[model samples]
Target: MVANRTRRLSVRNISVVILVLVVIYALVGFVGLPWWLERVLPERLEKHMGWQAEVGDIHVNPFVMSVEVLDLDAEDSDGEPVVAFDRFYTNLGVWRLVTGVVGLQNIELEEPYIRLDLLEDYSVNFARDWQANNPPAEDAPADDSDSAEPMRLQFDRFRVAGGELLFRDFSQEAQEDFRVTPLDLALNDLATWPREDSESNYYLLAAVGSQTIEWEGDLSIAPIYSRGFIKLGGVTHTTLQHFLKPYLPYQLRDGRVTLSTRYELQSADELFLTTSDGQLDIENLGLGLAGHDDELLTADRIRVGDISFGLNSRNVSTGTLDTDGVNLSLYRDADGAINLLEPFRNEADEEPADDSSDTDMPFRWTVAGVELGNSSVNWRDEQPRTGADLSLTDLSISVDELSDQLEEPVNYKADATLGGGGRVVINGQATPAPFTLEAGIAGSDIVLAQFGAYINEAANLDVRDGSLSVDGNLDLDQQQDPLTGTFSGAGEIASLDLRLGDSDERLIGWQTLRLEPIEYNVAPARLEIGTVTLAGPTVNVVRGGDGLH
Candidate 1:
């Protein structure tokens, strides 16, 4: 009877111990772990990073070794949110620890936002003070043989969605601000240790202002190699104007650029980059003179197609370059200097030799073809006493091919209207290496009265109304000491009315005058005329007592 009573007491004691263990497991897994994650973790984070941290809720599943954090926020001393996230979820592979590897099934972040501020001294906001307070630790001598290898890390999947990054620069006077929002990124099967599975498939997409940037392909971190495609669309120049403001004399009023290319990068021995099958487009470009209201240039679009570039080879090639609706403005001030060239005037002083030239490889580039349509140039000359304005409209130019290392001549053609009264056309072939050009030029109905200022200054004569026509061929050779050119032409001047020094009376009048089979050379300054024909000519000369006019 005593033995039976002892046996019952032992069984009761075992039941009590099992019940207590169940209670402890329930409390820690369902309650205590969540509380520590939500409260203690944030406190420790704030203490280490000098930032206030807040977590809305945390959920932990001890059995699965998984964690989920919701509405986490970290703010700087100024109460500015430096980092925030809506949700973070990760699951650890606890069994993998036995194999000396840290493994995660998946890691995900949603609605993560980060703000970065750059100061005038080129320091970032969060790092400025922290780095100053905590200098890098001194390196200690160690024997490599005694060192233990770092633990390997692996993840089946990692993802970020609805991410935003804001970058503000106080270095510029204008305080440039840029933001990338709606950033979505994904990487699959990533591992720190080198293996056949180390090459991860990655994709990134983001919106930068109104633009969209995308990158996708395979990447390996251990060997540092990537092969992918990158596309940038509608990247506005206004967003990046701060980078050019310090170096350019003009203001970038407006523009957008787009580029798409396939790229490969390798960093095993030396860094190398290559891109192929690229296309670039620029649209609605406008440039204006600094501190002036006048626009220097404007273009509707420029496109380059079939581009290939290599960084290590220092080579660039494009199949075609095309442009449309371009306009250029030029002005000559009263001082006989062009306003558009004011910034470059009197720059005869030799420039300092660039040190980089000694270390840098020479670049080689080529363009298969070029086309420009609907372009115009407007020129205003205040040097003329009366101020003259001239316009070249309906201008179109074409080039067959051009390159820095061309052995054959490149063919080109151009056509335009001058001052709404004359038509000009030129066809040429040029070789850049030898610097030679052979061109055929033709012009008709060129009003001579438009050049009255130059005519009056050169010969003390005024031209009221006249028209000139010419057909010619010119060959130029820069190899010559004086940059000589040869011209063979036939020309005619018709309906010319000339006067002397503001006089009302006509000094000379001609119905038609012609010079045929003319040959001119610039170097030796020679002119040969085969025939001179005058249809009707009249001259009025008065011998005044004061002077002979």
Candidate 2:
């Protein structure tokens, strides 16, 4: 009976305690909690961020708070604008209000734009100003400060659908200058108070035209720093390297960058570029440079189907270059301009020497061919000391077509001379002139009647399948008024037939003529055949120099 009474009394006491606790929870949640929150929340946010904010239309059952901003702007103590947002609507997390934590569920901004002008010299100064005015709360200190305890602001997520951040004065004039237009940014998975007094680590994704860049990176809101090392492919701009410097490390300014595809370049193609492993020191910041350091403007190793030539250069002003395997060296003056070629001028070292008599100059020349080997001419004192061996190959000359309607044409094979002594060599078929005929003319027929009329008065003669063959001495004497020569041949003519063709009939027959001597006039184009006797059926006359009819 005692144990039952103790157990029943204990159960009755627990039921009374639970009923009081339930009543208290209901009063705070559905009735008075929202009223107290509306008065207390705005004060806390204004004291923390130094910005004016208003909360309207609070609901307690479903736990919702609608925040509306009439005007919002932040400036440095010097009154320079940092950021501004106007006419904003956002929904707050009701659970956060109950837990005494400030959190937003959804934030919708209507046409907000930010202007950021970061000059090279004033960046650090602006950072200092930002630190001083927005001092950390007593409970949370700023990250960049030296204090052991740091301030932090925590947030679940934040989204901005349409906005623009205009950055001006991002680079020096001579370095890599650029401008970014229409900036739209979105962040996800953001937690502001990541560590003690530290900024958030977020997943960032942004798009510029067709190119989308994404990275898992960390950003510190307190000290204002962010870094995302990522690969951006298919961005085809020759000046992209110059434009990406502000966001990248200083070392990448002169570092090696490997491009996947070759960029078509304008102007002269040859260029030498140095991009080895190096450090870039910009405004006292060190950065690592990586990628290819050679000529950045070449298609040398590109995978194009057919290999074509291209030019690449590092120093366009004064470096050597190669285009399609042709090597060329370029030079420039001190002013960084190309040095132009100068005109021919007399030099001080080439002044004329005092002299009267003409001095003998010595010259040596070598000539050789298949039949003649190693022929040389050494001229001393204007006279040729010549020993030349010359071989004549495929040398032939012939006159075809003797009709009045047609002009006689002479055709000859090309000849090459190799070996001989002296400056002249008499070889091959004998002609009335000093010129040599090739061996191909050995069996050609000769009509003396046509030749006699063209040269001088000569006897009627005929040679069938006969060739004029002569091996003789050639004398060239330019010291006299009229230069002359003699050509003698000892070849027989077969079936000799002679009758100068009249206007009536075409005289045609073969005749044998005796060997004769021909005299040639070197002054003018003339030839004189000596007296000849025809031996055949119409052996008409043995003439001194007359035609036989």
Candidate 3:
């Protein structure tokens, strides 16, 4: 009986002590702490941060080790909002308070509005604060070097909800005025201490002009690392033209461009972001040049597979790039200038130095391969009345090892059907510099009827009927200025007939014509023909007095 009575007293006394402690903590947190902070923090923040600040109400519950700051607002000197929040919340560990220190386990900024801007002179409103917080080595004190004793702040989880951000830049007044609004983001499981289970993850969504952008990914703080994906969707077509017009030298009359990209990032060093993997999709892109209604370039779809790039050090690599339903028109304008070359004429090519001592190379790109499907092209000249206009349809090309470095030969194989049911095959390997190439080109059943109109317009002549068959193999070298190349081919034109442009009367006819074993040299501008054969050739000489010959 005595032992049981003593046990009961001890339990009661322990419960009583806990109850008293809870009450005291409640008094301090719910009443005393809130009141004190509301009075002191608001006054001190404005003076210390050099900004206008306000705090509506503060709430603390030491029992739960939580704090809530409500209706906080801050503005810059220009009366623009630096930050405003409906509520700011934080979670603290109760046991940690015993050490007379505050450690935050989590923090949340709810319905926050943050505004950032850059002026014409490339100055930002928060430049000073940002520089102070992230100082360069030369500007920082020697003692606070990279190996210094690290500051300890336990912020594990951070979250933002119903947040909005506006970013603007006034750099290029005419074209560089940019803005994004109604930004929303969320971040969770950010830990300073090492965690083996998982990693920090985040998601951000925003609107830029008429486009919507979204990103979701993982991130870490110490030894900073990140791995995530970003997506951009719902971009309007006309918005692209308006934005691109100022950057290009040519006028863009009209175009329809839709872009959607999903990118994956895995940084080897955590600094170069582009050296990763991703996909790019562009749809219904059409570009037309000035002074004409003809399209310069058109494509139904362009997609890039796994991609990696690091322009900071000029290292880039990409997987297969596929383009579908593409149509390109290469034309010479009335001024005897090719439309394709005009764009590059205005672009200043970076001149290379003579040696490594004078130059820092900036290009080291590698592409695994490229594939084109169901494409077509038209090559024409407008300067000549009857210049050749050739069309290739159902075109496909497979290219491999296209790199800026000559370490590997670029290999390509292509096949295309002529407009009138003829087909051609081309296969080649070439080096970019100290140029060398070995190629084979073969075509069959190239009906001359396809060129009837071209000959009529260009040479004031007509093609009655003809077909061509060609087989060729060539080797070319541009390594030396003299430019050496050799080709062995035999081509035959059969059952050919010709007439004057405006008349259907036949002037000449041939049963067969062939050329074989041809060679060419650029330095001397000469053509070597091993043999030429003609059979059953006939011509009607219309004498001055002749009527219909």
Model 2 residue 507 CA deviation (Å) reads 51
Task: Pick out the ten consecutive residues of candidate 1 with the lowest summed lDDT.
Answer: 128-137
* Candidate 1 TM-score, true structure as reference: 0.90
TM-score of each: 0.90, 0.30, 0.72
Clash counts for all predictions: 0, 31, 3
Q: Summarize candidate 3's per-residue lDDT along 377-448 as a digit string, tens digits.
A: 998877666566778999999998687778468889999999775899999888878888888989888989
Query: lDDT per residue, candidate 2, 1-549, as tens digits?
Result: 999999999999999898888777666766677677666655654455343445553435433555455345554444555455554666667676565556666555644555565556647434545465478689884576665544332355565545555445544554332233233344543443434544444443444444344444456543344544333333333234456644533222222222221123222233322221111111111123244232211211111111112233311111111112111122333343321121112233586877654434322211111121222211112111211112222222222212221122223222222122111233333232333333321222333322333222333322222322333333333334565443333344555334443322224444466545555555575666666656653423343455633
Candidate 1 wrong stretches, greater than 4 Å: 1-26, 132-150, 247-249, 343-350, 353-361
Candidate that beats the other on lDDT, 2 or 3, i.e. the better one: 3
Q: Give the lDDT of residue 325 in candidate 2.
A: 15
Best-performing candidate as measured by TM-score: 1
Clashing pairs in 1: none
Candidate 3 similarity to native, TM-score: 0.72
